[model samples]
Target: MSFDEMDVESIWMDGEFVEWDEAQIHVLTHGLHYGTGVFEGIRCYDTAKGPAIFRWDEHIERLYDSAKPYDMEIPYDKEELTEATLELIRREGLESCYIRPIAYYGYGMLGLNPSDCDEEVAIAAWPWGAYLGEDALENGVDVAISSWRKYASSQIPTNAKTTGTYINSVLASLEAESNGYVEAIVLNKEGNVAEGPGENLFIVRDGELYTPGLAESILDGITRQSVIEIAEDLGYTVHDDATISRGELYTADELFFTGTAAEVTPIRSVDDNQIGSGTKGPITDQIQTKFFEIVEEQPEEYEHWFMPVEQ
Candidate 1:
């Protein structure tokens, strides 16, 4: 569909809504040249109350956090951005959508350094569904252990979702897709299972949940954290530890990936070995069901995380 004709799509450029084709940046933009931008991928769910931004506050907090290491200062305040996001969703009359807020180094004198540019912000929204394969939720996905290794904290902070960092994910994802795998599992510099290219990794063993710890160059995924809390509430003990070997993956009774776009997806196999009888395991399915329920209504503890848009 044409940009304007596409229902429930809005592009917020600079400080206002613009035609999708009109949202352009100069070639000299520092972020374009040097990958010096930081952005957040957020989801808005249609609920009984109209539309609710899932974990809106947490996503904005991470957007700001992602900017700090690059010394980039965002121009807008939290409440302002939040309001803009809500308005954009409402204007589009969207039921469910994907929202993006980006802070980047704008047009500037060209070269390696970025000091000559100003930081610019843009927000956009579009109707979005599952980010992965159609059967990814039910049949689960097959993943290859990528030859590409994840970046070390000493080289670049993995904690921040910087544009520069995603090159690693891009290459790994390309490699995985080319090889007929749905995603790639990148290992840390030390050969530990770091995470899926775009999501955090979780495995279930004997009915308990296990995921890579924060120190292992993970993104500290909001969905991962939410799943942990939900798992505990459901009486499942969770483990956060370094997943050092492929042996753990092959032996695990269940596996999954978690992120903003990923939501909760079970991993049916790794490389060629089947994960627990080659089907979505019971605990993984349980957590996935609970997650869907939780996002549909704000649990008392997570109430502050959501922002409601009027119908």
Candidate 2:
């Protein structure tokens, strides 16, 4: 839903809470012109305990890490940003919402060098449902291999979540939608399966899980790490560093995408070729079920995964 349709009223910006409609940035901002900003996408879930942020610490760490390569320093500390987010959610009275924290170079002299630009930060939260659609969570989605290849780390730091680097994803997403598919699978420079537009890819074969390693030009997704742990705890072997070819996707026993938004959505088909039974396979179901259970129930065994908003 758009911000106009939500009940949100305020956004935390540059150390203060401002009216959402008033949270504006100048057109001359360096980040806007050069894409020199870093950001994070986080989720606050209504769990059995209360409203909580899932893997908030990891997200915050990534936000800082993303800024490092650009030589940008966020003006606020981790505690500052964390408190600001919690207060924003509490003030907005949000039960479950998607949280976006962005730090970018503010208005400055227009040039390639951003040394003179001031750093600006803002946090906003809004309600969002299943990213791949609700039905996709159960029935799965159809995807295609994008003609656009994922940029290699040599060209850009693939590990960093820089705002400017997302043009690659935008192109891939546009191609997928225009091609009458639900999503796209991007390959790395070596023509091996890298990942989805925004999510990490996982393949299940012979009761073992295989995902491209970080070297495969994919983000080290927080959700991907969580799923690996959960699957291992359930007695499943996960090959976190496996190199998968494009052909393997069509022959896999099952496949899925993991991300803060997509969660554990299954991939039922690739380029119209049925994956296994062309449905959410049994292993995918087990892992997806456990993922939702942990988020909704906030079981004590996995308590470290959540940060209560009330705190």
Candidate 3:
């Protein structure tokens, strides 16, 4: 849904709540021009207790980690940001929503160096359903191998979710849409399966789970980590350092992408080749089932994964 149509009316910015329409930034914002900023995409699910954020602490930590490579420090501590986000959600009266916390170089000097510019932070929440589509979660999505290659670690800090790096993702995802596909799968410099435009890649073969490691220039996604832990706990062996080749996509038994936004979506076809059964595989179903059970159901054993919001 569009932001205007959503129920959100207020945004937490710089320690104060501002009307959604009033949270404006200047045109000359340093991050806008230079793309030197860090951000996080978080999801708050409507649990029986209230709206609780999934893995809130881990996501907050990653936001700070993302800013480190650029030497940009978020002026506020984690507590301040977390409290602000929760309050913003409460104010919106949202049962479920996507939360975006961004720290950017705001209006000031236009030079390449952002040290002279102001560091501004804002937390905005809006109602969003599936990122790809609701059907993608159940029916799976058609993917294509993008001609664009993922940036190598030697070229830039791939681990950081910097605003500039997403330009590459934008290009790849656009390519997929133009080619009549739902999403794009990017390869690393060495032609290894890196990840999707904004999510991590995972393949299931022979009842095992495998994904590209940290060295593959793929972002260490929190959801990706959660799935790995979940799979292991469910008695499946996970291989973290699987340098999958381009041809592997065509032959993998089952494949899926994981992210805060994508969640656990199955890939039915790649480049027009059908995956196992041409649908979500058994292993993918099991993992996805367990993931939602924890996120949406809030079972006691996985309680630590959620940060309950008291209404």
Candidate 4:
């Protein structure tokens, strides 16, 4: 059967497995209205051993953590959602797919307050190859420094993965595309580089690695943390501090972005200035290669991050 013909089941409204086509939510749902929800992006990789969920525990933990700032309680516990996500992927027989878990305030009487609405959880899986398409990493992406600044912690918790906060990212991304750029780097209110619209930013300079510090008003991404750990383990010196000025990014030896969806993608240019001869640098390529190997190779040390699913 073709991929489209394959039966896919999803966990709907309160954890009911229904045909994917039948999964529905009201238009007036609180989350839809005021964006009162939080979500996660997880990847399941098809390996020689079987299909394994990558960083399964980390993703689930972040899902709950993201909800805390919004005061949105996930109706299910960690293990509950964990097992359900695995089951959803298996039901679809997806060897390699992306899993999305969302917890949001369901339909309720119209008002801005979300505490009155019941929380709804849903899990959906689909075949996802690359988030930004194939050529994004191969040739490196052209990035623009967005006019939209990252939301300050005073406005909303900068750490949580809230749907509401993504409006800024959405706007930045759309603007970048319309301006002939593949992605955007959003700065903080103080005009310091924070991160990519949905990814963490890293720069290499003088044989040292640098990324915006935690207080830089960027989401502390799981993939960003993993990349840093992997780099340190490989004997690289990392400097986490403020990254300001376009001059810094333009003159860096290499520039790259890290996140669940973006993975480790190299940036070829920032606006019109060429970064390191306008090509994917050596360090960026090394980290990307190592990341792929670990995600697919099942190294003993990283085995705990994978949840095996086999028929």
Against the true structure, whose TM-score is highest? 2
Q: Which pairs clash in model 1?
A: none
What's the CA error at residue 126 for candidate 4, in Å? 0.7
Please give the ranking of all candidate structures by lDDT, highest first, separated by commas. Answer: 2, 3, 1, 4
Ranking by TM-score: 2, 3, 1, 4
Weakest lDDT window of 10 consecutive positions for candidate 2: 1-10
Give me the displacement of residue 242 in model 1, in angstroms: 3.3
- For model 2, residues 1-311, the per-residue Cα lDDT tens digits are 87689889999999999999999999999999999999999999999999999999999999999999889989999999999999999999999999999999999778889989999999999999999999999899999999999999998989999999899999999999999999999999999999998999999999999999999999989999999999999999999999999999999999999999999999999999999999999999999999999999999999999999997
Q: Write the per-residue lDDT of candidate 4 for residues 22-95, one digit (tens) a residue.
A: 78889989999888889888888887678998888888888888898778889999878877877787777789
lDDT for 66 (candidate 3): 93
lDDT of 1 at 302: 65
- 95-180: candidate 3 lDDT, tens digit per residue: 78889999999988999988889899999989878899989999899999999999999998898888988999999999999999
Candidate 1 steric clashes: 0
User: What pairs collide in candidate 2?
Assistant: none
Off by over 4 Å in 1: 1-5, 299-302
Summarize candidate 1's per-residue lDDT along 34-81 as a digit string, tens digits: 899999999988865557899888889999999998888898889788
Models 1 onward score TM values of: 0.95, 0.99, 0.98, 0.95
TM-score of 2: 0.99
Evaluate model 3: give its TM-score: 0.98
| Distance from true location, Cα of 173 in model 4, Å | 0.6
Backbone collision tally, model 2: 0
RMSD of 2: 0.6
The 0-to-1 C-alpha lDDT of every candidate, in the order given, reads: 0.86, 0.95, 0.92, 0.85
